[model samples]
Target: MAGWMNLVNEWLVPALVLSSLAAHLVVVVLAAVRRREASGWPRAILWLANQAADLAATQTLGNLFLGSTSREKHLVAFWVSFLLIHMGRPDNISAYSMEDSVLSARSVIEAIFQIAGAIYVLIKHIIIGGGGGGDGRTFVLASITMFLVGIVKYAERIGALWLGDLGSIQSSGKKLKRASLSVGHLEISDDEQALQAAHRLLHITKGAFADYSSDEVEHKSSHANDEQARLAAARRLLHIARGTFADGNDNGSRWSWSQGWEQLFRLVEMELSLMYDVLYTKAAVIHTWHGYCIRFASLHFTAIAFWLFSLSSKDGYRWSDVYITYLLLIVTFLLEVRWLLSALASTWTYAFLINTNSGLRHAALCSGRWRRLRRFVMSLDLCRLALVRDPSSYRMWSGKIGQYNLLSECTHDMTSFYRTLAQRFGSEDSWKEYKYCYSGVLHISSPVRNILFNNIWDKLKLAYKPEEMRAMAAMPVPHDNDARRRNKLDKALRFAPELQDYILTYHLATDIFLQCSGQKGAACAFVKTIEVLSNYMLFLSVVRPYMLPGLKIHSLYTATRDALHDIW
Candidate 1:
């Protein structure tokens, strides 16, 4: 038993260090997968890797503190610095979801503890040790430099989380003032144009919807042609319209519609893609001034430490430990370089360059050479093309909506037991997962998309004012005095005051109609359209209550489910 314990202890720290490195590699490699519509396995793997990164690093640090088996204290101390760097996480990711940003306080506490542990490890293993080879001062300085770099990175992550928090977002909605320069004369590809436009219009989603105005907030450039500005404005308006709806803060909003349906659809997709970046990724941190500072500092300190370590004596350390140290240093340097390059080539940086004047730096960045270089870097598609063979197959969104039917759920019950268990003992997320497990998705066909767009477009054309847009949510049934005398729909409408009630009622009615129609009109595409729209409405009410207005829709769904089960 003692021999087994010894063996485990001997191999554990190195194994954990390597595991942590592997996890970091996974994170960096999969960094381009920012869309929620990406495969669930990649997301799941990324999530696990994110969790394992800190776990492996923290555990290894603990092991080192508890007296590691290695005799090379200096090498072990150097490994401690690398562990700290690992804990800071990669630049491309910070939160896996919105919930993570909200729980930034927890992350802060965890970072404090880890930083304390790292400092303790450094103090014990390097600062107090006296047996290393010639001129240990430079080695100690190198370790200290790497430690400072780790702290800066960790701070950057914490700041990112705080910046992305919902409360912070709500409070600082007016802080992001419009830039002075609009992007112009850039001979770029379609994807690059979309990225540039998204970055330009990001402020609409990032801040209060009430603050947006085309003339007041839009960045205008004297060099930009009038036709170009008009086209960009049209695209921006479409993006803002969807952004306002997705944000859900504004009760009523009006946006000018000039773009075609295709452009409008693509604009919505790009807007959502941008929202994902702001809410879930490190875009909030890496696009700002301080973000640039931290990236430069990280690269600078890493290079300095590498040089210092190489110049310092390593006679006393084991060859294996020395090789591992070199590996860690080289990897850190390369990652920092990659992150810096990514930031420089980003659309945000392009926007920044167009906006700012930094003397020689401004001239260099604005030059045609810099534009060509940026174009070249973007053409590599390092994040997307490397991971996915066919770029066309990859999209920011899957362009499918969840399909659910209240009657179908009531009739074919499968997850009732699991859902009950979840409600009784599990978290809110568990309950949601089980309750909605049976829901499927359907691609919105092109004809259906056109019909939906035309209906909304017709309504918007009539709704000149914001209040009229808000009123458009109501069922605009043309009041036929004769039909009103014949039917009791007024009473039915009163009974279904809540959106949930209306959704369920429509869903049941549609299901009944479809069942009765059978093969009679099944050949018609409109039949499928009716079924699809009904299921989608039910899906919104059941699986994604927050997307709808008002509160307690989940409770309403639960009550409906119970009543249906009892009737059954």
Candidate 2:
């Protein structure tokens, strides 16, 4: 057992060191790929890598601190710096979710320890080992160069995380001022224009999600006569519409909407994409002058370090370790190059270039060279070209909502499964309730989209005043829906005070109504829409309770499930 332990320790450092690099590669490749994918597997892998990448590197650094006499000291010291660099994930993914960002304090402490550990490893292996000759000096120089770059990269990560944290943002207490969103007849004919437009409105969406209220007094009129003009109007309308999500009084009174549901959906989807970047990615930190400067500095230092390492002596190091070191250097350079290219082609960068009164604006926008460069970058969209049959295009969120049918689940019987597992955990009622709450997802159809759009539009038309609009928000359904229906709805609302209870009550009622009124032709479409929405609301209550107000009582859902089952 002692011999086995020794053997395990002997190979663990090299294995973990290489695993760190492999995890970095996995994270970068998977982060891009996962955006286009809706499956659980790609996201699962990406989340695992996002978590394990830092752990593997940190563990490897800790093992190096134990001191190895077999490996060359200079090579080990160089590897330590690379580990520090690896701690800063690629800009494509800074945090997997907002919860990760909320732990900013813990991250700061962890980063401090990791950085200190790397510095200690450098001191132990290089400065303490003594610079013996020309090769020794070169190695020390390379290590120091990488050490500076590593620190910069780590600082960027922590800053990005801090900027994303809700507590940090709320504590700042800065009021949001509306930007002058005057595009002045700028039509979105191409992807470049659309991207720039999205970038321009990115802040509005970010503020809306963060519960920041914006003050805009000017009311802009949109005379959208054609398709391009309508799209342009829709873009500006997004700025006003964002207030509704933030619970602000502004319900798009500032701008008139002339576009259809399709254009509105597209605009909302783009804003959601931007929101993802702001919250999860490094868009909060990058897309600034300093971000650009530090990125280029990191790139240059990496190139110089690679050159210095290559020029230094490799006589004492193992051939495999030397090759692995070279591999890390080359991969790091290539990843930085990829990030640079992507940033250049990004809409955020485009908005910065055109909006700013700098020479770069001319070089990037007016010059033919930058246009061609951006065009080239667009052609190399890694996520789009990854899978030929990938269905999602130019959309961020999967345009699908989950569906959990209480009535449907209650009807299905699993006798074999019931015999084996029904009473294993709890009572039969509990098992049945648990099974009933499992959800399935379905894409929103054109009819359902139209129904939703028309309903909201009708409500908006009715509410001319801001107070009226606010009052209407509490009434999800039309008050004038036949007298009997209204009476039934009011009665149901009396018993269901919590939002979750109300949703379940309405969902069950809607399911029963649909079952009874199985009308054909046009009425069938209405029935289907009702069914979809009812199931969707139930799905949200079960699966994503945080999105809705009020706490979700599992017992309520369980009791409802059992009652519905008994009735059937």
Candidate 3:
């Protein structure tokens, strides 16, 4: 019975060990192929090292179970040195090298250690006989120690792989977002141009969506329509603005663009909201996968460890039992390492999601503020029209004016709200805080500011009353030199052939407001407000002439010329 048992141990066990090692190598190779693009060199190195250890473990186990031949023992010792060389090292930062000199040096050192260990194992086995009993306690203790060391090494490798995956996902997401934003810049400036640009962007965005969706088929398809609708709405607004301007009814035409602009802005906000949702969903999926990997690895290691421990107890303290226990421990270590890596990957995914969500929120708030400002301008247009149609309709006109004033106040409140939110939720030093928190982007661009001022100027230029026109003209130019202010007045006159009389009226009205308020700055603010109105009128005048049938390049040029000449 003992002879039969020895034969089973010597032949059967070695063959099984060799087969397991081969399986591990195949699996590692497959995984490497699948993850090559995203996997860093460090991860690859660790994986290769693990495979080497498995190879060593197989050889060592075979030698112990078979008749502990000196050559076989020496081979096992060499593998130990190989494993030690990798295990003793700290992580390498750079993955790619023509030759890993450190690893090479360690390999040589391991060879020497392996020769020594092999000789020791061979001599002991020959003297005591292959089946000689040893202290079971020492063998069991050594097996356990080896098992733990293997586990630690495997855990480190797995952790590195998980973190690398997280980094790759984050980079892809950021690249997509940047592409979207680049497309967004097309929405700025003139209606027709902006519409065409937005349409092109929408097409590009859809293509990207299709590519990404192919990889993540589980994602809902609802967002596609939302993005399409947004682009369409923005284009519609541009068409309306062009139509209204061409009709020559400034107030009514402006109203068309205002409503369309509001719709388009809302759509943009919705698009941003959808982006946050998609990112969050992707993050959840990544986390789920990571958890699954951890659980699977843990179960695998636990089963192997339990099986080995059970057999070792039955066999008593023999070299073969010690070798089997060592193999089981190494397996357990590998699983534990995989779990650690999965956890780290999940953490990085969470960070990326949070960062993107915050950016989208900031964009939404900024769009909301712009929408409110549009409504305020529309209200003012209605009030002016009511007053002009019926001089005795003071009550009706006053109500409209009051509504307009309220809307203006609402816009200010919205600005304050955004400022508070930025301070609370965003990093103080981030670009979002700098651009949107205090309207820094709006402040820095003199050309855009001039455009806004021009729009406001257009409204003031249409004042029916001489006194009102005088009050507007008297409004100060905040940063304009005397020459610049005069130039603007000249430009306004060029757009509105009737503005020369209007300017005299505005100057008189300005004196009246100045006397009523002791504060000169208050008087200046009111004057600057009128200048803003003139700028708006200039914009309308330029846009209006181009709205006619048989639109020509000359017509466009004339409109711009009139506005620029008037402002200059």
Residues 139-227, candidate 1: write the lDDT tens digits.
87888899899877877777777876656664565355445323222211344455555565555544322223422323222222222
What stretches of model 3 exceed 4 Å from their correct place? 1-13, 25-30, 33-286, 289-312, 316-322, 346-348, 351-568
Shift in Å, residue 387, candidate 2: 5.6
TM-score of 1: 0.75
How well is each residue in 39-80 modelled by candidate 3, as lDDT tens digits? 234445445644554465436634554544442232232233
**Poorest lDDT segment (10 consecutive residues) of candidate 1:** 220-229
Off by over 4 Å in 2: 1-3, 32-39, 68-73, 170-194, 216-239, 242-257, 386-395, 413-439, 464-499, 516-524, 550-553, 566-568
Q: Give all candidate RMSDs, comma-separated.
A: 9.5, 8.6, 25.5
The residue ranges of model 1 lying beyond 4 angstroms of the native Cα positions read: 31-34, 66-70, 103-110, 130-135, 174-191, 209-258, 307-320, 360-366, 386-395, 413-439, 465-497, 519-523, 551-568
In model 2, the clashing pairs are none
The lDDT per prediction is: 0.63, 0.64, 0.36
Q: On TM-score, who's better, 1 or 3? A: 1
User: What lDDT does candidate 2 reach at residue 197?
Assistant: 54
Worst ten in a row by lDDT for model 2: 218-227
Which is the better candidate, 1 or 2, if ranked by TM-score? 2
